[model samples]
Target chain A: MSSSAHGGAPTGQGRAAALDPKREVQRFDLHQRLQHGLMASSFITLVVTGWPLTTHGIGSSQSLVELFGGMEATALIHRVAGVCMAVAAIYHVAYLGYLARARRLRFSMLPGPKDAADLVGNLMYFLGRQKHRPKFPRYTYFEKFDYWAVFWGVAIMVGSGLLRWYPDATTSIFPPFVYEIGLHAHADEALLASLAIFVWHFYNVHLRPQIFPMSWVFITGRMTVEELKEEHGAEYDEMMSELERSRPKTPAPAGVPAEAPPAPEDAGGAKP
Target chain B: MRVLPPTGPGFFPLLGGKPRATLILTTLLLAPFGTGHASGPASAPTTAPTAGKAGPLPDGALAADGFTGSEKIAPPDADPLRDARWCRLCHDDDHFESSAWRTTAHTEQVCRDCHSGYHFNPHLPAELGPEAATTNEGATPAKRRAAAWATCQPCHKDAVPEEGIRHGLPEPGKPAAENPPTCRDCHGDPHEVLLSKSLPPVERRRKMNDRCVACHGDAERMKAAGLDDHVPAAYGHSVHGRKLDLGGERAPGCVDCHGSHETKDLKDPEVGRATCGECHEHATPDFVTLGDHRPFTLEARPVSFFTLKFFGWLTFLTIFALSMHVLLDVYRSVRVIMAANRNDDTPGGHA
Candidate 1:
């Protein structure tokens, strides 16, 4: 249900103070936005086109098949979308590898022990069992879960989908049941992924009261300071401390504790 | 062994030599699939379930001109069905066969060709129909139907294969009263067999399936014929059947998977997959697990069975839990929002 899975991952091109120097802070980069865009389009295409053929054995009707003009045409469109998704996945992996090479990648989005504690604490606060909300770091557990789901979902879908697409080649290497398993897994995983995106991701990212309409961080790749403080208070505190050090000769921005002199006109604006 | 079917927009089998080709060519050339089967006198208990269903013709069926090629017999106006007398002068008023004989694939054939058994001279009229009430032929017309059925074996020798006589016609020795149904039951009146050449593949398939449904869909008729009525019910709910019901052009009809001159060679699962693979490329033997209208259960359809259960449960449980989380989050968020709003309204501790 997280809107900004990749958005929370810092680019390391600039720190948060250098990102905007204005009221807004950078949450996602252009690359992250593009990747999300690709994933979103291809995933939607695959689900719409694939659901009919995958569920052809059941309640899937002629209208579904006819929606894409028939089985042959639907199949063709499914293949094209499959290829696009496969490419998008490869592109993501390659980008991650490049980030690792540049030593710019951080493991903040990875799951850690604190995430479980945070989830329990957050739920307690929601249930009025606690006085305060749980403090969140750069990425929440939900965002991490959304990220890893795509990672796992893409692997399973692409692997099983390839096996199904080339059944003759697949069956030659493995048994017929292997192909059948691929078919089963492909269809089931699609349903699971679709549900996760529609219900969980949509609610957290777009439908939740706090993020209703949308979380514009996905589009603008930035969140305002007040929103950053509210949503990711831990990250905001850390960035404010860094901002404090960076502007030792100047004053802190308003709403942040001013521990230094008045600010200079030319701030460290790295064009966030 | 079953004959590997001839593939094309084929009506007759494209089995080896010149004769089969000639037959198909003539059938197609005749612009077959005439709109209406000439109105035979009513009260044949064996007709299709819907009356006048066979009356709906395929496109371009009636061109006023039929086969006039040098290869076959040509009437004066090149219209074989409307040809005058030797036969139609008296037969048109008496029999349903003469009026629409050209709509049938047997358009090239004349009267004595099928009737010559009763007549010694080819040109002489065979004493037939109501006028021949005193003759032995007219006294027992049911005998004439059996004789007419016997005439089909020669030209349509490939149709009644050793493998496929399981459904319609019984053994030759069985009397007319004992016979379950002959060719006319499924194929419409003997004179008009709803020429397949004139129909597009899907319409042809749909019309062919309509005939199958005629006999099989009727539970009472199937039971009377000592056949189970399960097939019609099962097939009607099948993916193929549903597509056909929804007017899909490429949907498999009764004979697409099951062979024509319909029978049950689909017992073998490999054969079943092969039939499915006609349209679905790379259809493994694993795919046809639901063959023969088997229930969609674990035993019959293990993969799909497990897929349904697993995915069904997963979707339900995941959505349910997530929805609960969302609701509690919403209620808590709303409460927090309200509390903050009250404090702001008072500009103090109104909370």
Candidate 2:
């Protein structure tokens, strides 16, 4: 295991990993990570400030409200968080437009026919019907679902939240009921989103046995070679082929080896 | 429940629920609680009673410039209920002690219906009768006083202690000081049950508005009870109140909108529509579909409830399915990780 795993893994087709020793694959670009960081911070702020109001006196909500000065202060902080979220959402839209204009727009994160197939394949693997797991691409169906869910969540929450924030103006244009609906939608959706993050998203990204404490991929924006190979093998293969095509153009001038030593033939990439 | 003429405004064949049922059942329920009979226009007020001057002069007498000489007008009837003179025989003419009945809507009602303890003993003169001696067997004066509300509750059954508005009734075994106001505290004395229906409709509404505002207006009381302080004032300034002030006969009063007996908080979503429906029978659906009683908050609308319920179920289902998926995914991932770890630890194994 150590021999084949640490050294260059040579396949039957003679496909080999080229020279990088670190074996670190960039999963998220700086722009995407910054957006994620902003969103995460804004969301946290919102939950901290707004949750006290939502739950009122339940649990530590009262203490939390007191900690933030008073209801008025807490509300002000919530508004600030709301503004932050708005900025992040707007930035994301602008980023999408930039991507479109630059002609580098990729719909890899968008769900497609392959995602459906992958979901079924993954379920089969989970049930032990398939010996090998599905080879995920740059974005799995789960990650796509998260992305779209956020899009939907942000739209509803922001629309309703803004209406609630400016009720006097809202009621002027719309019926009183519209303002009321805004409050309900904003509050209820916030709770649902918060709970989803704490439960489902948290487990997948952090609390799962494999990840345990957390996966630092959001912060580091990189994945280990094994992780890239196992979880996102298809993306890893694409990256490798791209690297192979480009490697000759950027060769070292000195006596450095171009590629690592290949695994022994006896290893055969066999399982225990 | 008012008596519905075969085709009166109060009766609608299309109307549904308790109001319609109450109207239908009025004939059956009317005879027993004689106070609220759905009969014709209520009886006319008789000439104000001029009782024996030997008793303390009624409070209003001092306010009057002078007293007219008592003419020997025959009493209306020998009915014990209607005659304030009967009560004045033993009781003084304080605010509601005896002759004050002449000033209120209850001049037509029997005193015995409300004040159950004091009874007639014909052997003695009406004034010197054993009013105290002939008591309600076991009930103390306070208990009898408290129980007297039982008489009002039969007609105003909606405002029972549990199901009605939060009137701050003391919990059982609590001190009497914590007890909510009895009927008399708000309605004034039973003998002089401050009736406004006999007045002009505008005056009636104004009088009711005042009474409702009395309790709801008390900021300290409302705060102590954890009730909304702005509600009474808000209601007074609402479209209904304004309409009523303009003498809109169809306009709703406090008792009309908030049931006298079974009053709930106006913000209660479940009751808001039905309460509005009592008057705006045709427009109830629209009112309900577009209504939001949380005038203070913009977080709610008629559609809000549906959205909330829908999202609540959606959240539950989504979380449930996702959690299951997560568990399965985790199990598989953990197994893969463990296998990889085992292979890594092995001396002569592969990746």
Candidate 3:
């Protein structure tokens, strides 16, 4: 019922966001949005430069090399993007630390028995075997998998990348074969990461029929109350119950102060 | 066959204790142009040039002729040729080689140091042509810039080990079996031979790799010399090649495994193994046997080969399964979304 619902968002995603009601629930904070943005941009850049270097353009890397101006420019751009990705990853860790320190970190994203059951239920529902759809919490199993996959990927990529970036130093500490191993890990993981991003991540966020064109939630960092109820019924119920408990005992505006504590759902990116 | 050397006193440098030593070196340089270099040994002729050719050697007598060893003489404060401004007076068109040389270690060297045959007098039509590494033709056989060999050989004469020397190696330009690996053939033109000392070690290796790739990359060129043509193409696919392609310049290039001049050592498996040990301390015999190129075959490295195969399958399957899940989810979500849109006749209802 808020008049200012979904009124203003920085990202210009009007086409997809027109259907969205007032962005009521904060699914991600500004910091989380920033992390996603950095990862997304740097991941695209790494993929663009990396594929050519991996396949050698199926025979000759000349065309791709020329596309980026030359081999040197391609290399410089790839490394710069790599550094951006590394910084983004490190920043995410720091963000997590800040959250944990503030006692605001939630375990909803962590996989549990319910997540497994929901995944099975969702599959059964999708196949028409189940009468009712699965009820999801704050984070779905797929989202958690996506998040954790990024963590694993960043660790593998950056770890192996540093070894390649400074081979002499790497060889001095570790054996030569270790550098070779890093080579394989860096190349193979890149392919896997690229595939996951292009297929799994893209399909979930952009290519799916219901979410076709794109998911502006990545940019707006918010979801409508109705969307929250439909997609994450359990989370909506939890927030509603918390709101009920925290509701003012006094009914009249004259008795109670005009200022009320922020709603429980606002905890995602709540004002300090 | 050659232009008579200019024996002017103006041509001579002001001398030190080694007066005749410098003259002998200049005459030795001149001898290769007109004398028997192909038919005879690399050593200079006994007879001295005219007194005009004789100059006071500012460098030690052997320094000009002594192309061997790593004698790195720094360029003088106002080295005229350091910027190639002086060389551009007549030879202006070939600025590429000059520009490249300006940044190289040999900024101190003048055009005349290597081009000992060119004189103050008018040159012949043949003399004006570029010193290319080509087949020995006509009555005069050693058509390659004999001066380039004289300039380079003295400094790097000992580069090929005594036993490893293939005097008539039949290099790229001069494909005849009797021809040696002319410094021109590998280094391109003598002027642009970049002793890229200022470059990072990896960059220098990469530059040298270009020279190796020039001949080896060309199937016809390699075939003419009876070398395997596929080696260069195969190397581009190898892990080492991929590393280089990824801008890991430190990866082993052609010269890193096979010596620049001592390529004969590659024929010996033991020599290749020893070279492998030089860089890779733990290189196995089987690994060393991968030769100049083929490094990633199943027989060479079954474990790594399998590992790559495993990753390929994993990537394909994971993506496929994830994609199917998304598809199935979307198939249901579309119906659910449409049903919700039907229930709610709002203009903003999602499709």
Candidate 4:
């Protein structure tokens, strides 16, 4: 994989080396991979510790609580996990701001008109109604959905959870009912987020036929050139065209050996 | 070789589980019982005595016609001419408890309604053998008790309530004997049952309180029932019990919170809101929705129930759709792989 910053093709000498047809391509950069890792760990922790409290008094839930050394300890772990999620959310926003200022923000992750068409095209192919696959860019609609789902989930869970965690203080500003509503939203959204990750995201990233047993892209932040060709052909083609456009070309004025026309002072100068 | 029950002085063993303090208090209050009558706040008839030969009114009032000189209101549906004379024959103080029975609300009922075999003379002859005494028809102690309890079920619908809780019934197939609560445990003997409403307001409240506490306050008994031993003390100290102690009519007692017969686990989400709603009707919906209770599980709260249902369906749909998509993709991939494999197996199929 390209180990350069911005996850784009390396320039100059490294570019020539990457021109090989079988080279690997950078997908997620270091910052992005770290953000994903943080989110994943925090989410798992929250689901583990929070589920028992949500289903308190049940035999299984009580046993889980005991396993964690009682409700107090489990609750403490849940709150700590919640705080980590909040930190990850804050860090992600900062990272986004940094990208936006740097003019390096890739709008490919944003949903567009093409996504709907691609979804239909992909479905048609899956249904055996078509032969050619729906050529995707860097980010497919599924990936974008997964990305935004986390953002939405974090907003809901953090907002509601704060009220529930500090109800005494929150109740002073908001009515008691607000706190309850917040808790409901928090807990319900948590379950939804957890299921989506385990089913949708897991299936797409790790459990798909070819990727069974896991995909190392999450850890390596890289995809092979074959994968880029198969999965993100449009992105690969666009990058190739840009590279061609930016290549240095020899100037006509450098070869002034034969009869050459002299440029006129008043008219636009013509050179051989 | 019979074992004597552990009890304080003058403790009434007839009530199987009354605490020592409660028994002492009952004895103190019933000190006048030696006079052949229970004299207390409950003894006073609610209505004044009539001036002429007349029967007692159901509400204990003298007939209005006697004082106002107007047409008398018809008495209740009780048959004044019912032959219960045979009941008094064998049930007089000489053979049984007849004093309290005469004063009970059940005076209107004939003896046969309860003791089904009482109408006939079932007494064995004096020359009967000892084995014949034990083998008498319809005379087993267990059978008699079962018949008497069965007679109560029609009127008292939930004779043994909260069947789901089993009210401390033994686990199926276990050797342990469970002391399940029965009707007599709270209401006392059916023959001489005194209605709580018949007592004065204070006495009525105290009677209801004491009736429930008699069994619930026994720490060992509560533990055996898999119930909270501290429940009686907790109720006694709560705002409801405290206010009842202060003679406030608004305060709810034990029966009001945990129902008299239909007592269920308060851990139920709906029970909390519903029980509280009886008094704070307006606040019930808000109280229930507001999640005052913690660790709300799917079965407990309506919100959780609906939330779980929504997520459960959503999860099912999402998984089904995604799985179908993945399976189709896998199928297509496998078909291509097989096709490629076949092509390679054929002669001249180059890489």
Off by over 4 Å in 3: A1-23, A58-69, A248-272, B1-234, B238-257, B264-294, B333-351
lDDT of 3 by residue, A1-272 (tens): 01113533322232223223433555666887787888889888888877777776354565676688666687778899999999988887787678788776666556799988988998988776785667678777777778888888889898988877765566557655666667678899998888788877777667766456776677766666666666677776776665456455533332221112232222122110
Better of 2 and 4 by DockQ: 2
Query: Which residue segments of model 4 deviate by more than 4 Å?
Result: A1-16, A54-60, A168-172, A175-177, A249-272, B1-320, B345-351
How far in Å is the alpha carbon of B310 misplaced in model 4? 5.5
Clashing pairs in 3: B7-B52, B7-B53, B67-B154, B67-B155, B68-B154, B68-B155
TM-score of each: 0.63, 0.50, 0.57, 0.49
Judging by lDDT, tell me the better candidate of 3 and 4.
3
**DockQ, in order, for the candidates?**
0.22, 0.16, 0.17, 0.10
| Reference interface contacts recovered per candidate | 0.29, 0.30, 0.28, 0.14
User: lDDT scores for all predictions?
Assistant: 0.58, 0.55, 0.58, 0.54
Model 1 lDDT per residue over B1-351, tens place: 011112222211232323333433433443343212221111111111112222222112122233211222223343222222213322443333434544566656655445543221011223333323322333343543455456666677787664557665554554443445555556765456666778777678778877888777777776666766667766765656655654556778887787656665665777877786777676666556433665446886576677668767976887787778778788787887777787766321111
Off by over 4 Å in 2: A1-21, A57-59, A247-272, B1-302, B334-351
lDDT of 3 by residue, B130-199 (tens): 4422323331224453534445666666763435655333233453433454665666654555665667
**Which RMSD values do the candidates have, in order?**
14.2, 19.7, 13.1, 21.3
- Considering every candidate listed, which one attains the maximal DockQ? 1
Residues A1-272, model 4: lDDT tens digits: 11211233433233353354444555666766777777788889889887864554356765776687655576678899889888877777787778778665556667898888888887777666777667776677677777777777788888988876765456556655566567567767777787778876787777765557677777776665555656666766766665556445523233221111111011100000
Q: What order do you get sorting by lDDT, best first?
A: 1, 3, 2, 4
Q: What is the lDDT of residue A1 in candidate 1?
A: 20
